[model samples]
Target chain A: MDRRDFLRLGSAAFTTATFFPQLSFAGTLPHGWLNGFKDNQGRYGVAYIDQKLQAEVLFHTPLRLHGIYKHPTRDLIVAPARRPDTELYVFDVTTKSIKVITADEGRHFYGHGQFNQDGTLYFTTENAYDEERGMVGVYDVTQGFKRIAEWSSGGIGPHQMRLYKNRLIIANGGILTHPDTGRATLNMDDMAPNLTYIDITTGQITQQFSLSEDLQHLSIRHIDVDDNGIVYMGLQDQVKNRRDLPLVWKTNGDTLDMMDEPVEGWEIFNGYIGSVSTNTHGLCVASPRGGCAHIWDQTGTTYIKQKDVCGVSKNADGSFILTSGEGIVRDLDGQNQRHALHFDNHCQAV
Target chain B: MKRFFLFSFLLLSPIAVQAAPSMQEMSLKVTEEFILPAYDDFAKQAHAQSELWGETCDAEKLKPAFQKTSDAWAKVQHINFGPITSLLRRDRLYHWPERRNSISKSINKSLADKDPASLDLDKFASTSVALQGLPALERLLYSDGLLDGDFACKLGHTIALNIEKIATGTDKDWQEALVNIKEGIAHPIYFESMDEVAIRFFTEMLAGFQMITDQKIALPLSSSLKKANGKRAEGWRSNRSTRYIQQNSLALMAMAKPFMSFMPDDVEKQVVAQFTVFARAANALPLSIKDGVKDEEGRAKIKKFLDETRTTRNLLVQTFTKHLGLTVGFNSLDGD
Candidate 1:
């Protein structure tokens, strides 16, 4: 089939098999998972996988998305375009429609964001590219998600933030890039990555923690917090030929410490952790380059081998749902479900 | 008798499925034919240079030796994983794209100190990586009057020895890695499967092309002729920047040959033809990369060559990923 026909068939399948049923809105919204994905025909979109594993493509766009976020108390989901791109898609579950959120002039989304407890305000990690600054863009959810205000992220490339009490914890990935160069890090020789926490109300920096000088090249990219208020980070080493560097770190709001390396060594992850998620059991970090998911708990570190695995989230029962670019969704029970969609970097259990 | 028969049957069984055998063959060929020999040659040339520097620190005699060692490095430098990645050996061998005058500053610091104890092999290895690599030697030899002093000559010899040590260690590590691959042992630092090995080689090949196009060519070429910076070119001091591209293209071709069997005949032919075109164009470039980027015609020629390199890389990415069924993960390939 031609490319158009293939995409048409995909949309038809989506409408018939998944979209129609979801549009009824008869009972309470079903529990589902949200992730950005690229279909077999190379179309980028966000998919909502229902409990039965039926994925409904809320919308497709030309921009590739990275992190998928769901509204706190509403049927709204947002998929931010990956860095160097200018658009973010906000999908309304009840209406089955999507609204485009454009980054302000001279700014672009870093593909991650979070909603406040009441969902009145939304915050996104963004890059003020022209100034080489990281920004936390606050949106007025009550005003049609308009760009309300922006705060300095306390470092360069801020990615993957989490809300803890009144603080917005940001992983300031120190690599500096301009859209002109298209994600090429300009300051690799001296990049200073830090974990910065800002007050949600005032956008003032509450605290910031940085790695030692030797480990300055480790970009603090992804963050997660457990029930104990301990924060975890997934790092991407900016330097090449660094095999022994740590990829996961944890903080107790005071000091940042590297986690113990898996018995197999850090080289297996190829120095990149695509996603980090925490559960009641413990922490799970996905390494897409390494094609493995590592779990750390009281039982020590163990890994599940799956090719191209990246997006990982905690299921309701505390078990992890792992997705991959190879279009496989795997659970801790060893069950594998195949799909025609290539899952992107981050997923959320909505 | 029945137990013995069952054991024999199990031993004779072929565990690899259809794609696995091709991947296994590709990995084995790449390891045995290309990676091992390339590194072995580098180690040999480095050791020879070190011995020559020890015998006589004359610039004339050592310059030829340095070029030989550098060329040998150009062949195997694309293999960035496994043993070469350990101990910062790769950067210690040739720290290029030296930012903020790091190499110059480090070299001057060492010269000012002039302490013999610091030149000891182990102590030197622990020193700044910039001073322990080929670039330091290049600066010492190619720059006028820099090596005339006794301490500077000794330092050059020490850098040669350091390169030799790193090259030898990397070669030995690759040998052990090959053994692990052959025995099907799950090496934590290297490969747990033949598929993984193939992917590593493929990734390196793509990265090699990218390095050539982006760093080797475009960095020096810059945007326009007026903005061209010759010193930005790698190996600009030795005037072998263009030669490095040719050598890298040839080495990548050698590494890519084993995977051709896994692709269709047309794809195999296209890849071969494209590599041949790119290699010839790269080899035929008359001026050094340092000189070539200075003028409009030269810049045009280099730009055409860069386009060809990118085309070749895209072809390889399309064909290799498709035929090998390798999902170059979106997140893994370019994750934010």
Candidate 2:
């Protein structure tokens, strides 16, 4: 009937299902809980569920969200709009209130952002659509999320960037699609999608690596970092001639190694991968299109299939918690939890 | 306080009940009118095709039945989520948008080895799905390699029979599923509420448009007309890309009809007009969508049609649903 009543209903619905087996782990649990959107009835907003699976808070958004970023030093969460969207919502988890912000003129969110250390600055990948460029918007978080500067993401259609120390590792999905044409990749044959490492302070591209000539069609879209600081990237292959191309790659600052999977195993992915995350064991990648999630060990080898799952994030001890669009959540061992909500493609531990 | 709350709920109950019947009627009519009948037609045509294949292994005899079955499939392919998804029946029916010619490769290997298992209808169930669907049948019937008395024709006959079996079985499944859905709606579990059922229907319809827009057209069109690639079109192997999309638009238009009463009258007209424009442009395209992509005028026409279909999809997804007082919370097509 009202905010308190709806919250009570949500909490009772979520926490009453306590019959699930205890999810065993080997190390200290993550400090904070999981945060993602609780989408239902075509209405969506941020949702926070604690370690005990207690529903903490829920807030509504007028537009769809992409990834969630926790403030470096506060109880705030920042979620950007899905690409071609011009809005962003900053939710203060403590107060359960949100502040909406608009991207500057001629720019729109590429759906991901991360705060620099100490939460002083926020950087997001954006489309300089009119300029045919991929630019990163730098916000002075202390100055009320001010747009202080902009930098090239080092390629076109940049999506999913992360902070590695002081540098930014960006997966510049090379396919150029205009918001006007609506998600159609303007350049497939001649388009170049690359992974770039940039110096965040100066907005300079420190290093960039393009896929080999034969693998140019693989748009490196999502990325995650292993405990060892190696960046593992997942690709959505755009070429129709080949579906067996490797969909997972790992990088150590300079070079990229295409991880191998059995031909049949790769076929299960159907050439589209949605998200990637890393844990102590290895990297976890999701293919929502293929309805499969895969794991590759730290060596960047040894592929394993966990069928019919997606929306993966790491637990404190480095095991994976997976969610599905069907509203089921479970860990690697399959201790299941259910709620009346659709889990979007991204989830993370704050 | 409790007494007052109870009184208010009682006062509002009739109004809530009054809103549900129209939603129920819409869902029921769609299942009864469009979805069930299309799957039924698919089953009947597939059975006829199998019978023709059995009567004569001749491709000429089999071709007409094959096309009829394919057209039937296109009409109902929008049901990609429910009963047909069971046992990979949908993929087994037509593995278009195939990977690296796997269908041809699997078929070729089976034929080359003269795999006795290929002739066994039951054994074909466990075979790679690539060899089991309409695509395989189209290949065996229309490709030049198959002779009337050849082993490949025997395999083709077995596949045809298998497709018939799946189609018939799927139709039965749909009937049973509809029964369960109706029961669930009345009881509110298979779907949480009547609103959910309506939302699910709209979402599926939206998903159908997404498949046409993303996989069928945009994937091939790439960024521009100059860079078009026809190989990405669905049903490229059969050269039925445009035909397939035409059937899809027709089916989608039919689906929108029952929901028209729920929408503003002009919205209905606008939605239908858009579909009609796209369908005309789609049907008028040259022999194959791939070939169409190679010609400047043809590409322009195809692009215009795709843009129109996208607009129609947006209306159904955003405006139509909102007007119907439904919400689609999320679309898988809206990726990160």
Candidate 3:
């Protein structure tokens, strides 16, 4: 379709009342979403889509946000600044005001957080730059998101996280980096990335599973849990030429299983996975670098090629909604829907 | 020389730093001068090599033709985005540092069976990507000094023909992309902003530099010179690893040239000086990069060249990108 047509469709797709009726969800789904977006003018914002499926800027951020977390019980959404940016904004939909939480000196948010099931406490991935260690900064949500405690994230660059039962699963990316140097990866050769499950109540590590020795350089950075409680993780290989390494893995809290991908389509993933989603149907991984989305089930896998596509979250009907930096939104079947803002990365379905 | 240096210093001083060209101008110029010409030249050379292959079966006669095509490819190899990538021509033309023995093995098996269909360009394009481009031709021409038969020559000819067809198609695709940019119409997803476009261009150039330094030099030379593995270097199958660096650096220099024209005089001169030194070293290297990595002095020279390129890259990031008002995006690799 032409640009004008796309613009019209985009506006119509988000036109408050009319949009929801067109959705297969029928406006009945209780949960909607929160995501990070950069507009055409390079401004960053945390956007919210309520139960009506209407999307708008809830609040603006100074820098790009990599991850957005919603409190399980509260009407609050916490957006941590991307790497090297210490600003974190906590916005309450009910109040329409945001409170800023700054990381302690030398500590920066890794752009991911997860709250306990009851929303009493919150866990954030942080980097202790000076010490070259990763820390999970714990906050008591009952007391104004206060910084109350901290725990080791079990690896160097802890990124995305998912709460499973009472345990928090952190994807410790393993590559060493310092905020002082500004995003330059320090230890690629000796990177030992792993999937660490920590007991949130006691702030103690429960278990960790790592990729095999040859595949250690695949930085396990993003994670999500399926309906069956299977943790699916996404990885980006630190080494560029190792195109054959697996970018998606499944774990049962004991062993990591890599889904078999056809070599031709796998190489197009460009040794990185942009985002991953798991719904009642199956698992989907987005590859903006490779310009494709990989969907897999127990029987087979399919790759849907779309340029700059990254943000992916499950729709109410179990289908996946994919967003791109191009200001376009599409479903897994190549159906182009519209959103007004350019999607930055992860699209979280709350 | 002293007077010229003084003039450059005044122009580059913070007080006199001039405004760079708009991102639109930068994009148009790069597309016209660097990208289009590089792809055009490769298409011509690949077609010519294919014709030469059809005329003779002698290894000596065909080797130079193959080298010309491969050399042409190295110039445009860094243009891995847009049309070339969409067509899968980037990997189809040269799946390097991945196993090339597979290409050799596939070609030999086809030749042994007198695979008549292998001579068809359409058929070959559908075949394994490894057997479709320069790496395949390199194997057919250089592996064990050219296999002994007319079928081998036919296979090489077909591969060259396939590359010519692919390159010509790629040139057309790029021309369309350039048109979209010039017209401010969005045909590709990355046309969100001129700043975004500039960032993409700079990122690719930076990635090219990274490949030359990290993959070509550092990985092979991991730990120390003594522990370096020559086989790990790019283009090792054809002993053109050094040549790969030289050509890749030159292309990167060409892409960065437009930015240089817009920079303050002193910064431009400094960057050019470093680039000149690096290019000279690159050109003066031994033909076979693998052999160069085997010795101490040679290894030192290569390392120094790598360092110079890194310095030039930094100047581009810190000075030119800032002057142009281009902002680099986070998560180029690990997206989510």
TM-score of each: 0.86, 0.63, 0.59
RMSD of each: 7.1, 10.4, 12.7
Better candidate number, 2 or 3, judged by DockQ: 2
Docking class of 3: incorrect
Q: What is the per-residue lDDT of model 3 for residues A1-350, given as tens digits with 9 covering 90 to 100? A: 34465355335433211111122232232486767876554457766555444455555566788888877766778888888778777877655556888998779998888888888988899998878789999988889889999899998899999988998999999966665334655565567899998998788999999998757778898888986679998888665533555788898547988877754545667778878889888888888877778888765777786667788898887778877765566665545744556678888888
**Model 2, residue pairs in steric clash:** A42-B328, A42-B329, A174-A193, A186-B223
Candidate 2 chain A lowest-lDDT run of ten: A17-26
lDDT of each: 0.80, 0.71, 0.73
- Candidate maximizing TM-score: 1
Measured on C-alpha atoms, candidate 1 has an lDDT of 0.80
Q: Residue by residue across A1-350, what tens digits does model 1's lDDT show?
A: 34465346456544222232223234345787877887665667677666655555555667787888888988888777788887777777677666788899999988899999899999999998767799999999899899889999999999999998888999999977666445555566557899999999899998999988767878999999887778999999765545678889999558988899899888778888999999999899999888899999889999788888998999887778888887777778866776767888888898
User: Which of the two candidates, 1 or 2, achieves a greater lDDT against the reference?
Assistant: 1
How far off is residue A214 in model 3, in Å? 16
Q: How many residue pairs clash (N, CA or C atoms closer than 3 angstroms) in each of the candidate models, in the order given? A: 0, 4, 0
Better of 1 and 2 by DockQ: 1
Question: Residue B302: error of model 3 in Å?
Answer: 2.9
Which regions in candidate 2 have their CA more than 4 angstroms from the true location?
A1-65, A68-109, A113-158, A163-181, A185-350, B1-23, B146-149, B185-197, B261-270, B284-287, B330-333
Model 2: which docking level applies? incorrect
Order of quality (lDDT): 1, 3, 2
Best by DockQ: 1
